[model samples]
Target: MKERFRLWSRAQDASPPRIAAAKAPRAAAISSASRRPALPRGVRIYAVGDIHGCVDALDALLIRIANDVKSSPIRNWRIVTLGDYLDRGPSSREVVERLIKLNELNCLIALKGNHDVWLDTFIANPETFREWEPWGASATLVSYGLDLVSLGAPDRCAALAAEFARVLPREHADFLRNLRNHYVCGDYLFVHAGLRPRVALRDQKEADLIGIRQDFLRHNGAFEKFVIHGHTPVEAPDVHKHRINIDTGAYATNRLTCLVLEGAARRFLFSDTPLPD
Candidate 1:
């Protein structure tokens, strides 16, 4: 028997082929060639979590932000998504596209999650980013409309994979061009994953930056700046003063969350919106 696989979507959501009827976009999504994000006075930073391809929820997250934010003299704000932008949901392609659009509009700092590194490494390693083995780690292929169930039979899957091979998003490829590893501030270090436990920052490796979680979480380690991150999905935004894990696994739950802060104040904003499987 051939290796059997099921697509993540159901009939109501539209099959991969029918979804393929509307291929993923490859447009040059970078809007304004702006260099850096503006850090204006009284600015608020909306640090977001793992989107997991739920564009609708992301839109709602921002919409809630707009409605809730009171009008003021200086409304300079930043939208920082904590990586894992692709995979595990129905709209990974759409999420990336929207992020590109959002980046063009405001100050956006998209960090690199472990999944991102996996995808990027796959893309960079041509042997891994091909028809026989296109990108499909933890539901990326499904999110990109290439899951076997959606693509049909084995032969049909191969053909569709070949076609997807042709239409990979240039914008997404560009989006992964130079993703930042980690960010540091006065009180904390913002990372996609987390830091190694009981280790000094100077001794941490890039892999440790986006790969170590259990060790960091289980072990008792101290840091100069509290680490704020996403990737570990808990019931809530995992706010514990020292390290806050904000990845609420947005793709499946549809209940995406965010972490908001103004200089010293730390608060969280979340949106509960159901999405297509």
Candidate 2:
């Protein structure tokens, strides 16, 4: 299947005229020299930012992505989610389930975010709850039908872990455990957080992949691949020559963003409008 995707990506390189012909006048102004990095020829990617447990936004965003793809009809497509699939919002459990379902389609690539790791850590040792709760573990506990008070009790670490083990869906556990730190597709690298500056991609410290902030963000140097990441929240997608940040703080701002990439063109689909319950 991956080989098929590669072949398809290569075919897209030959049809620049078709792609250009479809571009709007405003987009046509994008000079060839200034064009954003291109994906492999036939491959298209829809990369979503930190979900932060906003299942409603996630659901709506998936609809928007589906509609966008349906209307545009791109083959060899893949969906890359920049993680933080749990916490902060009202439906962490549901968000995990939704991603699990999406992964079943065989095209979804999920990365691990710090919040996700925190959840796992808290589950194994509820003593971490003191810090985790304030970081948005309360909503995750509530979504799991667990009592925040009970789980947060000073002496209940073992009990909490046991309880969670009994009820946590195997599927969700598998999904979380199997998540990657980063994904490289064509010329873009998808990660939950930023990468360390001056380090080879292979030599990167794993912690920085989902935790680094100031250092990575401050560096203006170019990376081998255009890094697309989302550990840091932003009011809007930060598009730069070397990287793109799409985390729009969905848990609080109600905006879940998806960055779409086809050849060298980039666009976005956002779910900010509230969906009626």
Candidate 3:
């Protein structure tokens, strides 16, 4: 079945002609000979976008990635997940378990998303459940065999927190505690959300790294690195001179995207196969 899946490259003509014109000024303004963003020679990075607990999609995508590597081997490769591995889907528990195992293999670089951080906050202060509930917290709770109706009582914040902490596996807690805010590779910065304009990458705040939207999205200026991020859902992958957003709302749309960067080429692999609900 993995053999059937193929790497999908963005057609050169797929992008509107205006996009090049829009980006030309920024590239020229940055540097007269600014070359296309690229990774180190012979290195390949497969960065997966917001999982949102879609384990089936994650599993399928991993298989596709494995097949790609087997067919075309590279010496130095990395699989970086752009976070949101929990919430919004039916398999949050399974998702964490899979990620933990993958991390142990030393090939996975997991970045933290706002939802993943919220899970930690929710575990510590269940009062935050109110904030998370609207963003698919109940699905995660249910995945862990917790009854939302019982946990959702008006005054059960402490009780809910205690119950959650007790049920959460130790490795899972460790995984959440260890998630990185961002990762850099060659000329690309992989972050959960877009970066704040004009801020140095080293000084970016955690909150903005996993949550900020409009300010970063609206900024037309260039940054120190070409950013590849998730967090905001778009109908399709949004690629520009500055950043690439690969979050296609996997929890709802079932289209889990993985952006592939090898040298100067960019392509995509997707796990859009429907699974049983």
Candidate 4:
């Protein structure tokens, strides 16, 4: 498993595509009358983008964030990882292990992504691998010591999924299973994907929360709160008046983004050293 994980490490180092500058309107300084949401006084939130099995990037980003915290201390700090922690890259096992470790160290809020839901669905019915494989699930299986060709028969697929259940660590399984759909901190709403337009946060559908793309992505109206999400990969942290997307395609681009929020201030931190303005 270790050797197989190493083989794909180089793939994780490739630079991400440069997105045409984010088309969103430039955010201006917040004033007392500003409509934008704000975090609770004294609370600092670091919302990370979709990881997609890039353990190396994730580790680097975490260290960067820890260093940032050390430089400027805050009383309350939270780490919110928008999911897709599996698939696409190498070391899905390592990513989950690191997340488990992070949870022990900080106030961690892990949200479920569509890929994670697919994994749970596959665990319930291995036949879904037919659907999951093409969407990068094969990489996750490979990390767990399963070969794609080995699941040729439906029965074999089911058997392999059972074996996966037995082999996957209980801590990781629980971490995935117990992930939240969304978390509300002060005035910001953290979700794995964009929410359905006009739907109240509490009334949002599960599909929209973790899977909806275009409809949620294109909406320009205000949501119940400022929606901080991942799922739809943007070239950079696309900040708009209505939403903020920070996925940055970590698995393919090797740049994991983190959105930092304190009071009404917003900034970005990536896997690399240069911080966003």
Candidate 5:
């Protein structure tokens, strides 16, 4: 399995077509009555949306980010991935491996997404494979060298789970276990999914942090901090007065998004040309 992963990684290392960066139209003009939300001086953030196991797209975006930094350098910067790094795509194991490698260099802050949580649960309780199957869990299993044709039976779930646990690298398990629920920096709150409206940051539940949808999406009121998140897929990066959604549904659309924030300004980098808004 390890040798297979290495070969896959090498194959993915071939250069992909260059991605472009575009400035998002400003969401709103700053009013004299209220201060614009800004990161602390010298800090810039590159927050990536749900990966969903698209390793090739992930590779392109990371290269674009590195190029962006070279062209416009900042001493204090971060790459925060708004997680969903598993399932729904063919390269789930490779995706985790790539992130784990980046993390070792201290260049990434990976948050937990709903699909990622499913992986943890599946590991502990193989019975949950029944629940995860519809959400591309089979793709993930295949990524780890599992032959679904042989293990696809409902009765084989436990055997499949045991095989997965045995084949999964210890480091990969450690990476998933240690992923953060959310990360706060200056005025922006980074989460996998949107936070629950009206709930204090300290009081927000993990369930809501990874899964809340309509309540977080429909709220027009300001959050405790301006939020940057991904879970729900948007055709484009949905920029509102209060938050930004960057998930472009990589697995299906092959378009991944990276929301670049510096001071109060916002722009985007894409793994492929963004679909028409």
Candidate 6:
């Protein structure tokens, strides 16, 4: 199984097209075979990396997961999303709605990623809007639901901005306001980005969790229980000896990855599937 997984991951890394094809079939298979049993218990921590506005993908993944747990013999099911829940791709609005709904229904812990920090900054300081490229000012518009192009006149920018503010949903703002930075399961710490090897999980800054890539992944994580994260979409889930990365770059590509760690046996069940668009 290990060898087969390695081969699959490597084939995915072989090319961007290959990665998509690889992920799509693997996910499709899981959906077809997964039977709906009762929701499993016992702390099976299922983690997703970065979902950039892929609502359909997320929906499909969740349904399959539901089917999987129902068929399994367990007591509980828990999900940890590594952030990047908003921006890019399509359906940012729907994505937030679904996540909030998930939290309401089950045991879910959503962490903040760099994209989320950008979203926060966009909300707090709309002036910083011009800084980013295509995605710049996106969150501001999303929060307000006003088309920047439709502003039409320079004079309306401020008025449009205020209108946008008024239209903003209170709960939507509250959700972003309340998003947590990290999550821990058993011996492992799940972060959006990563932590400095020397720094304790509690000591890591908010910025560190949303951003920070290489210095963390490149280093021999050697942390306790392994740092499971999303943020940097890996070829597959980077199931190394120390860390696991399940972000399959859903926004850019069409694939979403999930890391399913069986609660009882402590074994890993990797399932990748398409977002139900």
> Per-residue lDDT of 134-250 in model 2, one digit per residue for the tens?
788768877989885856644576677678778888888888988999999887899999899989999998799999999989997788788999989887788765888889888
lDDT of 6 by residue, 1-277 (tens): 1221231332233322222454432221111113321113466777776778776666656655665576574565677888888777666777777777667665678887776655445445555455542552454355347666676423344455465567767776677777888776665678888877787766778887778888888886366446778878765556555666778877666677777776323333333442233
lDDT at position 104, candidate 1: 65
TM-score for all predictions?
Answer: 0.71, 0.84, 0.85, 0.85, 0.89, 0.76
Model 1 agreement with the true structure over 46-134: per-residue lDDT tens digits: 78888877776776676555544543223566677778877666777777777776666645787877667555555444344443233
| Candidate 4 Cα RMSD after full superposition onto the native fold (Å) | 6.0
Q: Which stretches in model 5 have alpha-carbon errors above 4 Å?
A: 1-33, 273-277
Regarding lDDT, does 4 or 5 come out ahead? 5
Candidate 4 at 154: error in angstroms?
7.8
Q: lDDT, candidate 2, residue 156? A: 71
**What local lDDT does model 5 show for residue 230?**
90
Between candidates 2 and 3, the lDDT winner = 3
Instruction: List model 5 lDDT by residue over 208-242, tens digit each.
Output: 99999999999988888888899898777888878
Q: Write the per-residue lDDT of candidate 3 for residues 11-72, one digit (tens) a residue.
A: 11122111111111112122313798899999999999999988777777776687678778
Model 3 global lDDT (CA atoms, 0 to 1): 0.80
Leading candidate by TM-score: 5
Pairs in clash, predicted candidate 1: none
The TM-score of candidate 5 is 0.89
TM-score of structure candidate 4: 0.85
- Which should have the higher lDDT, number 3 or number 5? 5
